[model samples]
Target: MADWNAGQYLKFEDERTRPSVDLLRRVPLSDPQSCADIGCGPGNSTELLVERFQNARVIGLDSSPAMLSKARERLPGLTFVEADIATWQPEERFDLIFANAVLQWVPDHPGLLARLVSFLKQGGCLAVQMPDNLDEPSHRLMEKVAHEGPWASRLTSASAAREKIGSFEDCYAWLQQAGCAIDLWQTTYVHPLEGAGAIIEWFKSTGLKPYLDLLAPEERVEYLRHYMEEIAKAYPAQADGKVLLRFPRRFFVAQRM
Candidate 1:
């Protein structure tokens, strides 16, 4: 099982919810009878699903026990389960499956997408949002630095492990082939935060997970410091004491035939 820090995951609940809310707004949920939130970290979006589908039985499924514990503590009445999205099977399927910022981690994008869509009832909706920033400088820099740096020898063994990342067109084509009417688009969220170090902190919670796990304790700190310095140079702060961060994300809403 992939280990994760509950405290660190839950800390970004509020920050994650901002984009989640925007994605949910585009969903055409008239009255879902049953809903599932895959990769429901800390139940941030799970709580929103509850309010949106009051009569529906909502289930929040995640692989992390720590995160599931936090979810249960925050919302006792709602259901939260420890399950991997790649292998999880619903007892009776769902009317709606809401997956926000989760698909990027799965190994088989096509297979995973097919499996999730198969669980949807006829006419049921599958709404998903994933980070499309793999092509951006933020992520590319990590790859560039890792492969060329002094620590490259240590990471060489794991270098072939590919992260499942796809383009908006790639997602749209896949969903269309699966026989779902798809609505796809890209949105760049410019989140303005206070001062320089805040962007580094934000990434530490979200984007730095994989890279951090690969480094030694001391090397991890040095890597982060070096990364922050590089990022700060490009995204200098304004006179008002804030930094504007452009985070590009892709959304796909597909309804079963």
Candidate 2:
């Protein structure tokens, strides 16, 4: 939202990164010459790719300068590029195009997935993972708050930027159209978050970013206050004071024909 604070994002790094590890494990490849991490975001997902394909050319791409800076700092030897995934065109195609937890942010599922598939070399793999948790309470609260009161008009842009996760059936169909053998599945991870207001802090770097960014500084305070109020009611603390966040994500690995 506001230049993507990598430090804030890494606060829940372990939980956020688990999906990348899981998604990487499912990618079937013997030897990929080149790999790209779309929406790499501080290079967490790209790091996983590097580990799996030690000799491959692994490049991390992201729109956020701050995120890329942190990524470059963390992985100095790796190449990181600043580019929007929605419009970026690489000089060379990749053997494995891995986009973990990123496609949801981009629009036009049918076209975007097709374009990504095109970036793959013949027999290359396109692996993607995205949050499908919009129906969940935390995200519902985001929609509810953004649509209520004076914030609605101001939040329209942020709302539009989000809310574009097409159905899994639609994505699978698109991969089929692109001529790929696909492995698609959904995983629901109930993460145990510690400390007070952890859920609010969790989304600060993610789902809450757009809403928080659109609001004025003062408005953001009131906006997040209201959001936290709703989150607290929805996600009550356990006896040890940890909150369980049910994060559901969908994954697909398509091997191009």
Let me know the TM-score candidate 2 reaches against the reference structure.
0.96
Model 1, range 1-257, lDDT digits (tens) per residue? 24667677655567668778887887877898999999998888889889888999999999988888888998999888899898998888788899998877777887788889999999888998887776666666666667766787776544234355676677877888888998888789887877557776776656666677778899988877777777777677888978887788888789988
Worst 10 residues of 2 by lDDT: 159-168
- Consecutive 10-residue window with the lowest summed lDDT within model 1: 155-164
* Candidate 1 backbone collisions, by pair: none
Off by over 4 Å in 2: none
Top model number, lDDT: 2
